[model samples]
Target chain A: MIRAHGYAAQNAKSPLVPFTFERRDPGDHDVVIEILYCGICHSDIHQVRNEWGNSTYPMVPGHEIVGRVSARGKGVTKFREGDLVGVGCFVDSCRECGSCKEGEEQFCTGGATFTYNGTERDGKTPTFGGYSSVLVTNEDYVLRVPEGLDLAAVAPLLCAGITTYSPLRRWKASQGQRVGVVGLGGLGHMGVKFAASFGCEVTVISTSARKEADARRLGASHFLVSTDPSAMAKAMGSFDFILDTVSASHDINALLGLLRRDGTLVLVGAPDKPLEIAAMGLIFGRKTIAGSLIGGIRETQEMLDYCGEKGIVSDVEVIPMQQVDAAYDRTVKGDVRYRFSIDMKSLST
Target chain B: MIRAHGYAAQNAKSPLVPFTFERRDPGDHDVVIEILYCGICHSDIHQVRNEWGNSTYPMVPGHEIVGRVSARGKGVTKFREGDLVGVGCFVDSCRECGSCKEGEEQFCTGGATFTYNGTERDGKTPTFGGYSSVLVTNEDYVLRVPEGLDLAAVAPLLCAGITTYSPLRRWKASQGQRVGVVGLGGLGHMGVKFAASFGCEVTVISTSARKEADARRLGASHFLVSTDPSAMAKAMGSFDFILDTVSASHDINALLGLLRRDGTLVLVGAPDKPLEIAAMGLIFGRKTIAGSLIGGIRETQEMLDYCGEKGIVSDVEVIPMQQVDAAYDRTVKGDVRYRFSIDMKSLST
Candidate 1:
């Protein structure tokens, strides 16, 4: 067993504190990664606080992991010692399942293993995540961190970046298509960048007028303050696709009306309450409300390659590992420009 | 104007009382329909009781209309006197809209004229529906009822039949697909019949164990009692498409879990409360929830022609016009087998 150290929530109501655990020795197809950086996602907050009600205790919550491969077992052909690789939301899946065969292992019928707060296939091993010093994952589940990206900023690509990119790709956001991102936070910022890189006319829709500059700086061509009635009314039935990244409870139907006929509104954020959608909003325009998770391993590699080609990485505010608790508070208040990445090197203290 | 007398609601709290109204004189593009039968939809009841909160008082509520053309103006090219025709939920729409040009006139951006409880474009005329003896509609919106279908049973086709058919057609429910209908009411029964006729393996999912025999009798290849743990567990991760027809709020995420990867759940019923869907349900499986209104005139005619070819019609219990109030009560209690059609000839008294 390999000794590992990280920050973990001892219980649902407790703040994260330093903890230590052991990881299994590398198997034939395993690659041990020295996790260099870990991005703090909104879900990390949700699961650590047990706001979602299903979170396991002693949880080390981080899936957006970026690091260098330290060791590789005999059969680990995908990676070698000192190679840069990444591990996203999932670590292992039943390879025999139909979804795995179709390259959609994330939706494995036999249950894929999540990076944190999840039990392994044996149902006894509690999985630790990227908040720790190191991780050993199967070769198939690990992704290639493309060259030429700020490795700290690229950590969020595993979750926030792929979460936004997969939906935009699925919805066919392309040249000449009008795309709208409904927030300007971690996920929304990536959505704007990806959509713009895809040659789309990107627009940002936000209730806060202050996000306009941030949106523009992130490559959005237009910004519409959703609270402004005249602007909102003028932009109605204009967008071909809308990437909704707001995790709070709001009127989803009001945004559904802004979609053009046959348009789609892809949801990347998970809200606590049910969204109130009027039937007229969807039926009158033939619109759709769909949800998307992080990309599959193959697609995640594709997204990384594309982002690397476009020279894009998440806009991040890097913090030392000890400041994670403070970062959590700032994230809750929506104070960050985008995402927060923890420098795991600081954990040695 | 032509004098018309029929049963109408004076207000939200009023019952069916005798009322008088005027029908427009057959214009150059108009066809005067001599109403024979009208199907009672759950929507008609909702509108009458103001359950949807947008009711216009003194309303006539019916849209599934079947009739014979009594008069056609000199310039009416599509129909002549004595031709059988049907009119569904809509009466008119701006033909120049993108939706109209795409043959989806039901979603016209320029405001499609609803059959009843709605004001016309002129702003003062309260358009009456098939509850009356005659209705004057523009020839373009009138559908040609093909030969061989039982006329009374065909009335529901204008509304329920087209409503189910449009989505099935949109989703391409053909051979080698597993289609699940989630309820056995007016809409569910029609969905089963159509999906079965389309050569797909059809299954009916109902919370009530008693609906099994009826589901099988309606041509369903299988019946899954959703309340039965063993049955639902066995049916999970099996369906290619699920057409949800129940309007009352229920757990949509549970049903969404039953969908195969990339499957879709088309909503035909309009529930008042918004559906609380789990993000994992959609993202992991690439599933979708889409809503479809009733078909346009062109597709309604196509549906009528298809039903005519198959000798298919609704399982309806016909009643005299005076019993509409009682029928509405039974409908609210979910007592009807499938649908109720009012015999318009009884309205002469």
Candidate 2:
């Protein structure tokens, strides 16, 4: 076991504090990553606070991780020492499952081993995430982070980027299609960038009028203040597709009405409670409401490579590891510009 | 105007009574259909009792119409005298809309003229439906009823048949897919037949255990009682596509769970209220929930031709025109075998 030290939440109510832990020794096909910048995801807040009820205590939570390959076992062919890589939402999945075979391992029937607050393949070994110094995982599960982007900004791309990119790509969003990004936070900002990069005309729909400037600067062609009744009414049946990234519960019927005939609304954010959806809303226009998780390893790599080629990266505010608790509070309040990537170098201080 | 007589609902609470009405005379590009059989839809009850709150007084509710073209104007190119034809949920749609041009006239932005309880193109004239003795509609909105099948059984095909078939084909439920039909009534029965004919492995999901035998008889290979928790649990992620024909608000999250990764659940029936859905259920499997209205005129014609080739028709109980009130009552009670096709000749009584 390798000695590791980082920040962790001692319990559901307490904020994250510095803690020491142990990681499994790198074995064959395993690459140990020196996590440089770990993005504080909204899910991290959810899990650390036990809001999802499945969280384990003394939890070191951070999944959107970008780092350098520090060490590897002899069988690790995908990564060399010092090569840039990323660890996303999960660390392992049942490789034999049909979803794994289809390169959609996130939906593996045997259950995926999440990076933190989750059991590993051994079922007894609890996995600690990138809120720490290092990560040891199979080479197949590690993504090759592309060169030529702000490393800290690219951290959230592992989660926020893939979450938005997968749906737009899966839905066949192409040029001339009108796309709406519902919320201008972590996921929506990326959705705007990627959809615009894909040549789609992007619109950001948000309750806050202040997000309009950032939405436009993020490559969105239009901004629809969701709170304005007349604005929402005029935008009805306008968008071909809508990406809803708001985690807080909102009116989905209004969003459903914004889509044109046969249009789709994809939800990536998981609200704690069930939403009230009218079946007539979908039936009237032959519309759809679909949901997507943060993508598979193969798709993650594709998204990274595409990001490199398209000059796409998430808008992130880099914070010191010690400020993670404050960051969590801000994230909950939607205070950040987009996302927060924790600077791990501050952990030693 | 041509005189017509049929059973009509004077108001929301009243039963149907013998009433006289008038339809516009056949114009150029129009055909006068002498109604032979008209299927009673669950929506007929909704309209007659103002359940949808859009019913016009003295509403004659029936959209699943099949008859002979008794008269045609000189410019009628699509139909000839004495030809069998059908009229579905709508009588007219704005031809220039993108939805109409794409052969999805049901979603016309200009609003479609429903066959019953709706106003005609001129806006002032109220349109009566197929429960009346005759229907004068443009040839473009008329569907040619195929020969070699029981005409009465084909009546429901105009509404119930197309409603199910459209989504199945739209979602591309083809050979090798595992399909589940929820409910065993008008829409589900056809869903089973069409899914089975499409070479998909069809499963009937119903709350009633009594539907098992008839489900298999209707071409379903499997029966799943949705109320059986253990059975439902065992059948989790078992379907590639599910056609939800249930109008009552049910557990959509459970239905979403039945879909495999990327599987879809399409709704044809409109629940009066909004349904509760968990975003996590859909996100976990990347599943979809879509809704479809009835097919457009062109696609309805295609469906008719396909049914002709496949020898498929709804399992219908023929009722006299005067029995529509009873049929509507029974329909609400879920007592009909599949559909109730009204024998219009009984109107003379």
Candidate 3:
């Protein structure tokens, strides 16, 4: 066992504070990552506060982990000491399942071992996430953080980046396609950057008019104030794909109408309540509403490489480990410009 | 104007009774057909009762028309007098839109003219459908029904057939795929037959065990009682595609779990109420819930020709024109084997 320290919520109602736990020693196929930075995702807040009601006690909630591989077990060939690597939402899955075999371990048949507040496949050991000094994961699930990108910025790519990139890739949003990204928060920001980098004509949609300039600054070609009826009307039946990143529930039917016939709306943000979709919205235009999780390991690596080539990294605000609680509150208030990556070295103090 | 006789409801509360109307004269691009049979679709019931709340009074509702082309206007090129013809949902649309140009006029940007209860392009005239003995439509909207098919049995193909066929073709459901057809009514039965004909492994999913035999008889390779937990559990994460054809509010999210990762659930039915979908159902498996209306002119014609080649016809209960009210009642109660096709010869009395 290895001693580890992290910020954790002792209970759903408690604020995160200093906590200590033990991480398993590197197994034959394991690589120990010395956590360098951890990006806070909306899901981190959801889990820490038990907003989703499944939070385990003493939860170290973070998944967007970037670190240097500090140690590799004998059989681990993918990573060695000091190699930069990343881990996303899941740490392990039943690799024998068809989905896992096809490299989509996110939908593993036996259910995936989530980064935190989730029981491992053994059903006894609870997993801790990356808001800590280190993490131990099988080499198969570790991602090579491509060279030349800012490490803090790339941290969110494990979650926010892959969440948006998976759907854009699946929906084939590329050159000559009109892609609209809803919201301008963490996930939406990455969606805009990725869609633009993919050679698509990217439009940012937001309820507030203030995001127009910010959206354009992030490489979006156009920004539509979603609250503006005229702008909404003009965009109706226009986009080939719409990456909806808003986590709060709103009228998705209105967004559905904006899609061109046979166009798709890919959802990454999980709303607290069930989404009520009007049947006519889908039937009338032959529209589709799909949802995507973070990509599989192979795809995540591909996304990192793609981002490296395109010089696309998240626009992030770096915060010290001590400010995680404040960052969580700011994230809830939508105050962050994009993402907040915690400097884990601050935990040493 | 050409005079025609049909059954129509005077108002939302009134029962349909014998009525008289007139169709526009065949224009340069029009073809006039003497109706021989028309199938009863669930939408016909919804519109007659104003279930969707957009009905026009004294509405004559029917879109699935099979007939012989009685006359062609001067410039009509696709059809000649005495040609077997059919007309499905839409009668006209703005031909200049990308959707219309791509032969998906049902999603016309400038508004596709519906077959019935729709305000015509001229604004004053209300379009009527094929419940009448005669229908005059632009030549492009009329389908060329192939020879050797029972015209009565072929009527449902115009609506239900094209509705199921379009999505299967769009999703590229073909050989080696596992296709699940939900429900065994007019639209679902057609979905099963078409999927089977496409050389896919077809499974019929219905709430009642009573449908199993009928499903097998309709070329289904297997039948699963959807309400049976063991059966549904066995089918989890197995199907490549699931075609939902029930036009009533039901638990759609439960069915999403049945799809293989990256699989799609295509909806052809238009339920009156909003559907509640859990975002996790789509995200966890990378699944989609899409809706498709009936095919446009070109694809409807293709479906008809395919049915002709495969000797496929709907499992229809033929009835006299007078029994339409009872058929509508039975349809609402889920009492019909599949579809109800009205033999217009009964109106000759």
Candidate 1: list runs displaced more than 4 Å. A1-23, A50-60, A347-349, B1-5, B11-21, B50-58, B276-284, B347-349
Q: Interface root mean square deviation for model 1, in Å?
A: 1.8
TM-score of each: 0.92, 0.98, 0.96
Better of 2 and 3 by DockQ: 2
lDDT value, residue A27 of candidate 1: 94
Output the number of the TM-score-best candidate: 2
Shift of residue B296 alpha carbon in model 1, Å: 1.6
DockQ of each candidate relative to the true complex: 0.49, 0.91, 0.85
Candidate 2 stretches greater than 4 Å from native: none
Classified by CAPRI criteria, candidate 2 counts as: high
Q: Write the per-residue lDDT of candidate 2 for residues B139-253, one digit (tens) a residue.
A: 9999998888999999999999999999999999999899999999999999999999999999999999999999999999999999999999999998999999999989898
Q: Which ten residues in a row have the lowest lDDT in candidate 1 chain A?
A: A272-281
For candidate 3, give the lDDT of residue A312: 89
List, residue by residue over A1-349, the lDDT tens digit for candidate 3. Answer: 9899999999988888999999999999999999999999989988888887787888998999999999989999888899999999999999999889999999888989999988788987999999999999999999998878899999999999999998999889999799999999999999999998889999998897888888999989998888888989988888999999998998899899889888999989888789999988998888999999888999999999898888888999999989988998999999999999999989997
Candidate 1 lDDT, tens digit per residue, B293-328?
Answer: 888788888999999999889999999899999999
**At residue A191, what lDDT does model 1 achieve?**
94
